[model samples]
Target: MTIAAYTLAAVLNVFILFIGVRFLLQPFAAAAGYGVPATQDRAYLEIKGVRDTTFGVVGLVLLIFAGAQAEAWYMLAVALAPIGDTFIVLRHGGSKAVAFGVHLATAAVVLISSALLFLA
Candidate 1:
């Protein structure tokens, strides 16, 4: 359980970091994958990239320096991003499948990670 908890948290953090980088480097593609299309203004896409990057770094820092409980709390709080994303996609004329399948599923996984971290 301990190993699984830590591994999951680490993997999630790294994966999010990768996503952040993808958003920064390939905003259009990233946005498409995120269940939304990029508009003319790239500002928001860049902001999302930075936000996700910061979150990934923070999660990794919490797990490494602050321990499982802190990581658990962080995970619990960060889950809100995906929850909000679900709505964002839905409201933006994105497909329901992507909205729920991607964003909601991510929220569920993040929540599960939080629960596992708490148990750890």
Candidate 2:
């Protein structure tokens, strides 16, 4: 249980880091993949990149230094970002399939990771 929890958390953090980098490097492509096609505003995409990168780093820092309980709390709180994303995608004329399949599924995985960390 402990191993699974830690591994999953680490993988999630790394994945988020990759996503952040993607957003920073290829904002338009990242936005399309995020279930919302971005317009002319470059700032928003850059902000999202920063936000995700920070989240990934923070999660890793918490897990490494603060331990499982702290990581669990962090995961629980951070899950809201994805949940909010689910709605954002839906409301912004994004595809329902992408909105639910990607963002909602991500939220569920984050929540499950939180629960696992809690149990660990």
Global CA lDDT computed for model 2: 0.93
lDDT, candidate 1, equals: 0.93
- Model 2, C-alpha of 63: deviation from truth (Å): 0.8
Model 1 lDDT, residue 17, Cα: 89
lDDT to native, each model: 0.93, 0.93
Count residue pairs with overlapping backbones in model 2: 0
Candidate 2 residue-wise lDDT, 6-117, digit = tens: 9999999998988988889999999999999987698899899999999999999999999899999999999999899999999989999998999999999999999999
Q: Could you give candidate 1's per-residue lDDT for residues 26-112 as a string of tens digits?
A: 988899999989866677888889989999999999999999999999999999999999999999999899999999998999999
Poorest 10 consecutive residues of model 1 by lDDT?
38-47
